[model samples]
Target chain A: MADAKPETKPKKTHQERMARKKQVIDERIAKATEERGVLILLKGNGKGKSSSAFGTMARCVGHGQKAAVIQFIKGRTETGEFKLFKDHPQIDWHVMGHGFTWETQDKTQDIAAAEKAWAQAEQLLQDDSLDMLVFDEMAYMFKYRYLELEPVLKALQNRPKNQHVIITGRVMPEGLLEIADTISDIRDERHAFRLGVKAQAGIEF
Target chain B: MADAKPETKPKKTHQERMARKKQVIDERIAKATEERGVLILLKGNGKGKSSSAFGTMARCVGHGQKAAVIQFIKGRTETGEFKLFKDHPQIDWHVMGHGFTWETQDKTQDIAAAEKAWAQAEQLLQDDSLDMLVFDEMAYMFKYRYLELEPVLKALQNRPKNQHVIITGRVMPEGLLEIADTISDIRDERHAFRLGVKAQAGIEF
Candidate 1:
């Protein structure tokens, strides 16, 4: 004999299913929010790596964190970022103040600038009070042999365990990647330069 | 007979002049370093603002500072920055997860997503424990009206006195400028998009 009771199907519409799915996803995200510790390597031929690094400095300052920035091979004149941060009491901003090698053409001067900047960076690296340190265009220093790789590697290794650091420029050394908790390669597929377009104000800069 | 002593003039080379100027500059910079409490605004269209912010985040984490990020209008999928920071136990990396309205044709959905993201950001704004807060692409939100202006103004004003904040994206509102202790407008003289070149991976994104 057939059962007297009829089977009842679950009543869930497509929207309801989606809502449920979203709730589940939200819960997972909330759970994941507790975990944090990241190392980011922004590489590639993109135009904004340095800009991005500065952005972080602004953020840190806003939150009351102490930060230091060492600019290598990019100090030609006063940049907007430099001007803004130069007088800030919270930041320890240092500029090697040497233009690129192509501009300087003096091996001794370039090396001297690199050494001077590296010295400051080393000090910051060892300072436990600094919350963040930026080695702007440091990769280029190693790539161009302006600074020794071994010392940089050693400094990074020996840096205050709690101190954070950022190194930016093209062509990152493999050793950096090996030790980096996070590595990002900024790939270049297309750029405005190939089209002979000048960088626009407030965009390319 | 006139007895005239030969004039003793010290001729200075360009390098020597430069060295003297540098010495003065270094002294001024060193003095500036002693002061604290600097605020900087990294604005403009040039690339690197957000990248710099993330770089700072990495540094903060390395240094053991508590940090957080609130990304607006950049949400589509997981970004490299988000992915890198998501699982870290020390950071609070939150993405609004709604791609820009220009990219998304659905205005209704865009506004909804923006509101959701704003809710999360509001929570961060109210929190006192956050050491650094990076508000990525916030200008776009203000420009697009994805969120209200008054509340944003209020939240920023009410932010923890010592907390650091970074707001990025092009075309900042006048209000933000007035309240910001430091403001940077990134001027782009040219861009790849004008040249009809595609954004290179790692560089553009």
Candidate 2:
């Protein structure tokens, strides 16, 4: 005992702690047994919310699964994602907004566009053939009162069993939050645009 | 003026507030004049860090730009991303780890693997031909002391001016944070895995 090195004790303790952590993680992994569709919400004033959704859509397409992208409040058709995925065989891409709310300035037109978009979304929600759907910037509809939250919530709840839904925007309503299987709130820690860097084509859009 | 209803006053006030917001946003947009590649850091204990990276990769490919991805600490070859992006013409994908640290448990081996990965990254950093590079799960190396921060920072600083770098993981080092032009902190508000929902193949992998 007297010959034992001081570092050995700490090393052993560290191993024990790691072992405990492993056990907990293993247990949690084992506990997760149910299999079904999930509603994932990506919100906050961050850079990657839409990017994350697109990435997952790519993954779904990679798996040979059918997917659809409904872009609200982003009317531009020249975005890199739109250009790439618009004609993809397994993807249905739609740009449904006139533009940003401030740019539109016409509440009636914005509401009409949102309603038309939601009408398509409502139909898509019932589509079991589609493995995934990306409701890009859908939260703004709720935040701006463009669409009723109840019907959207009900449609989400009643969607096909194995179809995953990904919603991305800057704000999330409480009703959507309650039913979300996963919620990722991306915080904006820093942005290049704030530092006098122009929003480049492939990076920002 | 005396005939104006209470709601009309609020409506005009709202428009004035929106006008001010639009001016601020326009001024900020105009102020950003510099154009260059960005170093984006995606960190925090949340999902979609790698997803966001891969999404941007797709965007880059959409624009006909070359990109590379170096995955650290994820050893699985059957991931959805690997299966989809590995064969892409514009993408150079490399997976360089035995497994998670807990699963490996060999400090010497992990360190060696990290070094090998960094060597490739260092070379890629100098390649102006590559438009973008993703060092996935790289922050763990710094947190675990498998790699030093100084050399990485220096390489990033000296990289091709038009080559963007994206680093993703749970914890970001101070050095990396300092150099990052854009940083997104994805917060885990809720997770399906914690609620007895199994990690699905396309969604979780």
Which candidate tops DockQ? 2
Residue pairs with clashing backbones, model 2 = none
Q: Put down candidate 1 lDDT per residue, B118-151, tens digits, no spaces.
A: 8888888788887668888887777877778888
C-alpha RMSD in Å of predicted model 1 compared with the true structure: 15.9
TM-score of chain A of each: 0.80, 0.91
> How does each model score on TM-score?
0.50, 0.93
Error of 2 at B12 (Å): 3.3
RMSD per model, one decimal: 15.9, 3.2
State the C-alpha lDDT per candidate. 0.64, 0.91
Model 2, chain A: how large is the TM-score? 0.91
True contacts kept of 2: 0.63
lDDT of 1: 0.64
